[model samples]
Target: MTKLLNVAGAISLLLGFIVSSNAVAVDEQPQSLSQLQSLGNNNQNISNSSLQQGTFNKTNRSGVLLPGEASAQELLPAAEEGLPPPFGANLFAGGYESERSDGLNDDYVVAPGDKVSVWLWGAVNQSEVLTVDNQSNLFITNVGPINVANVKASQLNQVVTERIKQVYKSSVSIYVNLLTATPVSVYITGSVIRPGQYAGVASDSVLYYLKRAGGIDSERGSYRSVKVLRNNEVIKEIDLYDFVLGGYLPRFNFKDGDVILVERQQATILVTGSVRNPFRFELDKDESIGTDLIKIARPYAKVSHVGVVGDRADGPFSIYVPFAEFAQFQLKDGDRVFFNDDIRAQIFDIQVAGSYLGPSYFAVKKDTRLYDLLAHIEVDPNLADFQSVYIQRKSVAQKQKELIDQSLERLERSVFTAPASSDGEASIRLQEGQMILQFTERARKIVPLGKVVIAENGKIANVLLEQGDIVHIPAKSDLVQVGGEVMMPQALVYNENATVEDYIAWAGGYSERANYEQIMVINPNGMVRLNATGALKPGDQILVLPKVDAKIMQNVKDITQIIYQIAVAANAIK
Candidate 1:
């Protein structure tokens, strides 16, 4: 008994949760149904960052992949044996929601054959559902026929109250309500697909008759302004924009002789990109704002930013407007609007390759500089050739190669036609070929860093880095060279175990004129070291200094400049 009671309790809880989750209070029948379906669609597609509310759909960000990028279609897993389709149906204009609103209207006037609830109090106590006769009047048990066909809903209460007063002689109070409006014969005409009379409930919404008469002619009809006329008098107007902005619709009850007029769409505005209908909307002259364009376009809800293209006195130009500012802007004739979405990226990925001692392949915000990257990345002060550092981009290398190929073609053409003695022609050709080959090799060769550089005037130059870009730090070189006032100027194989004194010893030891304190070390990466004692890598350069009292600062500066150039040339050659 206890187990059965627990199972029943769990089932009840589950049922309650489902009902409560879908509950929403709405005034109208059609609006409530549409809102509920829209809510469910929104809840499923929404980002976890925001709530699922409002009539507009939740922003689905996964639709933004560019061309050539990988997609889910190519990598879909095997499907299950049986599975249901995804939730929500494809929405389009004149879909289920529009057709539903076309049903009977609750506020329709009491027409012939309609049912009305009548109750009397005070003098005579009675309650009955009276029927209206074919003559557009209602007949009570004791009272005769009372006309009510042409009256508006607002005046129905007064009209019925006065009729009851005449019968009861002011002694009884009357309570009357139109239970159901009779079937109405309405004529739908002008700029519609099927323009004819349709038999429908008198209380049905205008959308009902519009559908029965076939939907409005999208090519010629104006969705912005639709009208309902009665006895040659305009009774109501419809704007599709109202529903798009939230849930706003006209309240007009249909009558037997009512005529629906779908006015001709006059002005045409072109809408494209990320919208349901990339078609040109034909609207009235009064509808000239950005909000008006959104109503007709039915773009994705996430496309909050819009761009309007128009011709100006200076030529053609475009302006970007956000969703919040749509109402503040107006459109002109021959204008084209584009609804666009914001890119979800604000940073770029870059790499520090080669000999840099830092994390490789990280991201930085846009407008980042090589200098900024260098500051963040670590370079060995003893081995790094800082002066020869360059930034490289794959795209820049491709463009450079194209230019080099073009120049080579032109050079080959000029070289073959050069005037030369017939006997020496082969020699000339060989020499020029060698020269061209060397130039071509240099051009074809792309450095790890693609010659991108920030200015030396500022640590952070104005170089904008892109994704997959490389910042290379060249490797340490071999064969440390010893020069200056050494007894025997010589170069020795660089060894990690070799010290400054040891290299000098291999050069027959330092000369009497050598300055021990001014011993200099030049790395292949262009790093100039003074009085360095660290063990050297391959190709490291060591120069024993000469004794110089003649402006020691100036002499040291000159040596630094000369050694820096040599290091740069060595790295460039490779």
Candidate 2:
């Protein structure tokens, strides 16, 4: 019987500890939910750090991987997971608190507990700073009690002056000023980060208290349904979007015990692409159309068309229409509207660099040919090498990078996954893998020049040019450059009769690590010849590639292939 009682006591203590641990409030009073959440978060962080430390110690003690840890590390994040954060989400980020006014507004009505300064100077010198009593009247020595409560700050001086004139008409100047306004304690509740009572002046804007309470809960709170309540009755409903779109916020003096409530989020639409504000917006009405959104979305570019996608009664539906018809289309909840400048313009701009005169950029038609542009280009015939002119394009560079990445990925997988028969072999494989990884990393940083080999048989190709293409007219040079594994890399005087080997020999020959058999001769137009027998030309460069020596023959072959690919794509020694 005693043992049973002891067990029951132990159980009661355990239950008490659990309940106490979750309690956020010191007593049985309502507390700020945001503060409670912060406290809980701190505890959670402490628990997580402790658990992680223990896990680390255990892992160190036993040299084996744990299932839970491995799975957690391997978890992959989804792409484009959720909608962009709602507009006006960052409105009440405590910046409004600094702008809080200490003075009362012109329209602010004087209430009890407010102080008013009254001075009568000319006829009778008298001054007194009087506080408004419960009867809403200010008592003066000469002019008995005057009802000044519920009076506008702008009209207070007029009212007081008129009352003083009744006593003394001539030589009596009255000066009236509001010394201080009554401080009101406002309750900020419902969908706010910290929902609690905050103290501020009666003339304080709703934003002042809202910011004091840690702003609105952006995800769950509605920017449209923020209500100012007095005695459980809503006096005003504020739509924050009005302030965000046009700098307009309604001026309403807060009273004591007034409540600032941020209601739950309403129906929303996601606006994306080509807009100044690409964010999810809450609808004022359920039946709102695309017209309502354009006012806030404010597409920065000329929106040619819009694509609307949403779940309808007929299942997922999508509509594509011109911007004119977009206003008539009614929107629903969770709809995604994409504004696109889809109409392809007739003219696009292309840049010209190197030996050229006049404007380097030309606005040409979409179907403009290379020869058509070259015809207009003014260049010095002595300086411009028109035969070796080439085109550099963005699309070509992207494609080259993609291909190089694919080859590197394949090489990495093959090298890392190769089986080891013994511990010594495994150690050797680890060192080789690290070296290969470093090489791949460095190779990935290489940006291909994306040179189009348009020059063939001393003639330039008259291919159709695309937007953003750079037309480079090579300047005529009388020097041949040799670099890479060469002992001395420099430019030599032009020798038309010199072969690839002759240039290398003149540049102090190749270093000990040079792959002599895999010599590369690169033309100014980014043409690669992988032999020593090619005819050397002025302004051409010769790169002596470094040889790869590895324990595994396959590793050597893979490394060699990547090195050669980098040379061809970038025309660099790497």
Candidate 3:
């Protein structure tokens, strides 16, 4: 009785406050079909006078809408941020405009305006689609009115069949089915994207109306306590998490003027990374345990550790805990949790390409050396060029790419930022900058092979092998190649007695743009020698670099350095 009095006093106080604020409280009617459609057209427009009354006037405890009271849309991050949309936000993506009323559930209660198809044969032949009247009675042609207002659809067949049997006396065969359910206009209020009246069939699930109302306000709306109010009392309470975590939504029939009040969000925790459902989850209480969060997060198999960060009594705090001990960890309101795959692997796989007869891939320990694996690699002695073996590492490629990008950036900055003393110099610089820009774009597309020189001076270095390394053993080749700024770039028969100049001469000499001083002789194992003039061996490549002439000596130097960087990184000239 004391608690009831306290509630009564609170209600009286709320009414007095509403009157004093000059806010007239009236029964808002459900919108028409056109108005409902217009409401969904723009979610921003739906929060007009009705929404202000529902969200601010009535639900506002302090009689004023605080800045902290934000709608669902306001809570979401900007689309430009590339963040994931809030959980259950996609539920209102539309398609709730029309729902089949014929698919009725067994527990659906009979209501006014609901159509029932009754067919009779045998003694009496009558087929009629009867509508339920206001008094919840379906009037038959000859039989008296049958009360089916509150009767379940499942029991309607039994009730109507028994009544017809009484009238026809075992001669009439009756078949009754709930043809169409009554359409209802439900008032959706509280923390939702659009707080307005939405029209849907009585048989339609609660999600239909919620979807039509633009789903729950992800930021402010409480998915844990969605109430369906009839008259002034709550008839059903829906927990959307039950539907999200476990595919379960409570069954309920909505009536006209029914209010679905989504209470403001309670305590929440933001979960991200290495979890199946990485979204902000609302808690039933201010404080919960890791076990409660585990049920919602559903971390992936690779996730072994959890990092939690939030405020504490002392100050802001953070802790990294193993997945096993997370169950016992205490979680607070507004905490941020991140699951991580922190455990290092004991063994990693590496691929071996070219000339080896054994398995293409091998899973080896972290301390496995290149020489240890090389000893086990079965190769044809006549075909395999073991002396030209090298390792291609992904990490090396990434580092080489970074260095090339940094050099290109520096080259671009130098070309564009060079001080021009006169208009003629500026014009020349502008034209040169454009040409350099084109060259830089072409250079940027080159992917470095990341060749690690394991063999030098005919000796293989037994270095530790890294993850994702490709150990390549070249095939025996008796061909010498000549390319880059040469008149005719082609592969020719290997001449062991020929020098670097002889290979360039055999390829029809250098072009007009070729830099005579910048000739490079590349070995089969990716070792580059500048202006090498000794006797060239088989599988050797002679590349003639292009000349770079700039008015500024620094520009010429930078371009030459970039050329060398590209030649070493990609083994090609730009």
Candidate 4:
């Protein structure tokens, strides 16, 4: 009852404050679709109003809103420095593709069962929807029979126009449109989940059939390449990577008797860089592999050294091979061979500092991204400022320095360009020049690298990196935040001697329902700790977990055991 009364009081106080301040405007529906989306749009109207009121505080009058209850602008906007999306939402939102195919190499051939409309205006003034016969012949009034078999779809109008012109002396306009594609029964064989004939349209996407057949036979299938054959001749090859990365399907419409064969991804290796023909090839056990690779990937004559990165059971290992022995050198599965003709090209280096243990500097290859480097660096979750990992590039710093220089030069010009003045005015101009020079010097001292803001979803942000980029990973700060079931969740100033108990006291301690023993602390690196020694740091967040009264929770005993363990360890550390 006491806890309920306290919460009620806080609510009443917040309401009274808002009513007194008149910070809120008239309630109306959001003006646009963008307002409905949680895309971090600025909510500055209320904040600006608060500032105008001379002084406004949130502690004694904390006005918050539940979702669907009110807008963040009207209530609690995402605190400016917003939190991450609930999880996996932003990461996988992009690269999501539909199973429908919308591309084709051919302009759509008029096949049997295809519905086409041919309109003969002017001389004849007639329109008819004609289904192409099995023999690819279209019967027309007055024009008789016209053979359209194996004819390009784009040429259908020209072909029909000529035929229609024959029936009339006056020039007549003809329009031909393919309404729908003919359905095809394609045979999917070899290394497929369910190899058999699948019924689909000629324009149907390959994924549709694969999905219907329960996907590929994982153990025996090839993920890199699949062949689409028309009359035993390879018409087109489909690479799954295209669909995965770009959501684009191959432009090959299946015919009635088309065959899709999935070859096994065996003895696969990649040859890239200076090689003329860089591709992934599957080899047969009896075939001479090295000779085939040499014939396919024609390396330049000047390429003396080739870097062969081999993947083995122990770990990944690479070695340099001579150009002479490149053909004869034995290759294995999962081997990546890179050929570089220029032996002494300039190298690119980047520094990834803070929250990392290894050498801060790394000599990376071209087109490396922020996430690519982040994958290699290991930061303690409890200490990392994940939302704001930033990149500082040398080029940006140079641009900023140039701008400062230009501004200082402009100020110097202003003094010279000024109308002729008295000696006292001249003395004031000299002082102003000195001030501009000092300001310029200060601006130059400001580092540009750390200023590039990195959002929580950097990958989705599509932040690119250039040469001499410095990726900054921050450690936990000095002000610790107390949240969860605290009477007043807030950030407290940290002292070297302060513990979690001291920080909780600063937050008005835990609420009546808070589980004191089951306290959860998220360290500076975003790591969760149970029964942590509450040696609070600037960025550490202490959460007083809520008690679950569910008797059906099977892990209740285990959780209690873990909580007790944490309590003991934390006290011992203290």
Candidate 5:
């Protein structure tokens, strides 16, 4: 008997441990059958007595047996008092303790048509199934339809005990069980990787539902404006960008039946133009700056005079700068850099060749003419071929045609003959890169030929010749030579019209050592000599013989006699 009692006690303790473990698992107070039955109130009422009796029978068989002398009825109460609350309540009221110690509010109560399961300790033979009706009440054996909804489980236990005390001799404990819960769900959509509805979502947080729906689509979604809708109304918008990067997730929590919507990303700026590579860059990060864009534009760009045409929200603005300056300047999106070649108009070069005074490259104004180029050269009057003068232009036929057309236009408009206007004449303006070659007709000859004539008083001599005309200079033997302390030495033609003074001038005039008194012209034909007044021509030689100091007086006398005789002859003629 002792061993049997020990075994029975061990079994009881094990059951107790199981019950305690179950009770500890309850997050909230155990709900009563009234709450569960109310969920299915329209259904048939379930009996609790049978369930309780079954529980009582099971406990009785597993424990110590009472004495044969002791009544089973008395033993039952003793047993009930010794057992947990469920057995005592079941013995009197066919129920268990409705009150629970777990922390939970009782404001949300189980209503009609609720299904509930009941468990009673030491009442294995009685019914433990129950449900609430549509009237928000549960019917018990001793206690009638008791209002359980909106009543705390702990409070309901006392109410059940009081009602059962009227029929039972001892106090009874009761337990309530709820088997159904309120339905709840939430919707997550818009820019989310997976947008859908989530059922059984708790009222605690929106993030739980969002996570279950999959996080925001970072590539195409905007974290800055995540909208939360409740009852079809936008209640709040959360910035997920801040939370994700800042490690602050608590700021965005969801409630039951809440809808979370991630918006799509907005439009961003695009950069192109004088850059190594042109592309569209996203403004997703905070590091996008104007200077950063310039770094990308450095290649494939002429840094000098980079032009930026900005298309902005307001109006368009244009900026130009050297490529270097542009790199130093901050750049922005939507700005286009246009690189163009600089066009200039100014002086240009032309080449001159052939028998020109100075054949070389010359710089002329953009609108210079062929005449302007020739004016610089010193043309030899006897050598230049004026009638054959021509300008050799170096250019393609097309260019030459264009030039001809322009020249004709100028001629027809009389622009060349027009007086200079304030703005300057068009014909005077030479086109850039034009070559002007001026030719001379006299330049083709190999020898020089011309006629020299002396004027009265021997003041000057003039040479007249046509373009390309050559004057034959007779060899030294075919000419007259005059020298002797003269101003200039001369070799003159014998038939030329030159006086003694003209010869003197040709010989660079007389020197201080010359004996001017004895000036004589020698003819190769004989020993006869002539005076200075005698006209000399081609093939004649004039010799101004020099005298020594000893013959000075004789020479002076002879000169005096000649002067007197010439004066007498001039007077007789008059």
Candidate 6:
């Protein structure tokens, strides 16, 4: 009895396990469309029943999961009912349906030469067809051409009714059919895949004409640069690329006589001057720097200098840069890049001496001009004559011919020449590590005689100076002498190119009492009267004289009048 009970218990446990698995599988199954709708209806019913019982919870009795069991197909109609029509939809859909029926007639008026069609409702023998041509009046009718062509179907029905009323007076209806329709033609040309004249089509819309002309040529055409020409003039540029690629709808519709044209791309960046391959490169992207120019010149180019030449609407600019340092530069479209092969070597030392720059000394590459060394040591302009400047140069065997040629050119141009034996004359080339000494016989004599006017507010006293050297200025004097009067006058030492107006300005200019219109300049050459606009010379004296006042002139005139009256009275007495 114990063995039998154990086997029975195992069988019952297996059966329970199988039933539980089947229950889970049934719960995981997907419901059909009809079943889903039934389930939704049941839920709604349950909520309603709970509400009637007055024991419904807030969460359980809110609403049904799918109200009214709405399907996916019904959702669009439901949404559209709650919204307004899209733009142009109301006008495009059934907007012109009311103006369709205005002409209708059914009647037959027979003439001897007229053809007419007539039909009775149930009598075929009463039907007749007739025609009228080239007569002032119909043979069997009283209707005329003026009355036939201008008459509407309804008006013709009224005329037939009046005629019938004269003969029997019967009511009748009439109908008319047009044998021809209106003609329309449009022409499509320029930048299209196939261009021709099309007929029986709408002439006012570009999209309608484009569809007739095989649309845009995407493989060989640019949709962005399309231009529409109307009556030989550009009306608009249609960006079809934006419409096709960006999903943008066009705003303005087309009109009659429009011509569409597509523009070609423009080439940019003219690379010329010493480049291996010089051509106009087209800019495919946003490029505004000189890097691409360097890349174009990298092959078969030394690139010693890269010159950027640009011309805007305002003006033009030219900038030269070393090729090694041109990486920091930027370029614009239409800019020209000139690649040169001639490279400049760096200078080690430059010389300084005499009227020259200095003794030959090693210097940097780009710092070997004449003005650079002149600023270093204080050189008196009055004592150091710069006009007769010269330079001494040394060259190895390899550079002998070139240096000689350069030297001869410099001498011919007077860049380097011999000195003149005078107070304001000297010459010599400067070498490196050499000192320059400038001296003048007059400077030595005037050093003991005190300061002479080298410049205004600056004095020069030549102490121990030698030949081929420079001198320093110590102090300046303020005294300027004015000999003749014009206005407030003073004295000034004469400069090399001093003029009469400069002296007048130094003496506080012309005063109000002075006659500036007539100024007299006195020099060793003699007195010369001149206007205020006249040029002045060194060692010249200016005379600023005051005009006679009006009061003094009036007093003199009164005295003369009194004397004349006395003389006249005495003569009358005699």
Clashes of each: 13, 0, 0, 16, 91, 55
Q: Could you tell me which 10 consecutive residues in candidate 6 have the lowest summed lDDT?
A: 16-25
Displacement of the residue 306 alpha carbon in candidate 6, Å: 0.7
Cα lDDT of model 1 overall? 0.57
Q: What is the lDDT of candidate 3?
A: 0.72
Per-residue lDDT over 1-574 for candidate 5, one digit per residue giving the tens place of the 0 to 100 score: 3433332232222111000000001112323212222343222222212111111111112112235522223212322233212101111231112322222223334545445554333322234556777676768654466666655433655554455456554433345565553334678899776799876412224454555556555456655566888879998876543453355544332345678787775433333344444433333343344455554334453223344555566886555444445446544543444432222223445454333444355554445433344444333444432222222222222342343334334433442233545443332222100101000111111111111111122121122111121212122244677754465656766545656777677777766545577665533221224464666644455655433233212123332332222221111100
Off by over 4 Å in 5: 1-170, 174-185, 203-205, 235-258, 265-574
lDDT of 4 by residue, 333-370 (tens): 76666665534323356777666555677655445544
RMSD of each: 26.5, 23.2, 24.6, 28.8, 55.2, 46.7
Taken over the whole model, the C-alpha lDDT of each candidate is: 0.57, 0.72, 0.72, 0.55, 0.40, 0.37
Best to worst by TM-score, what's the order? 3, 2, 1, 4, 5, 6
Q: TM-score winner between 3 and 4, please give it.
A: 3
At residue 185, give the lDDT of candidate 2.
Answer: 90
TM-score of 4: 0.36
Q: For residues 371-414, write the lDDT of model 2, one tens digit per residue.
A: 66666666676887766777888777777778778889989999
In candidate 1, residue 572 scores what lDDT? 19
Worst 10 residues of 5 by lDDT: 16-25
Ranking by lDDT: 2, 3, 1, 4, 5, 6
Candidate 2 stretches with Cα past 4 Å from truth are 1-80, 98-107, 119-125, 168-174, 231-233, 300-302, 313-315, 550-554
- Model 5 misses residue 129 by how many Å? 6.5
Which regions of candidate 1 are displaced past 4 Å?
1-106, 119-128, 134-136, 143-177, 273-279, 286-367, 377-464, 467-574
Per-residue lDDT of model 1, residues 1-574, tens digit only: 3433332232222111100000011122111111222333222222222122323433433333456743322221221122221111011235532443323244556667778788988889988898888887877767777788776555777888888788789678888877665677999999888899988776676666777777777666767678999999998888764654456777666778889998986676666667776666655684487777776677896676566666766886556655567556777765666666544334566776666665776566555544445555556756754444445666754554454455555655565565666866566455545544443444334232234432121122335567666665655556778876577778788778878899889989876656677666755433456787667766566765444233312223333332232222222111
Local accuracy of candidate 6 as per-residue lDDT tens digits, 359-378: 22323223333333333333
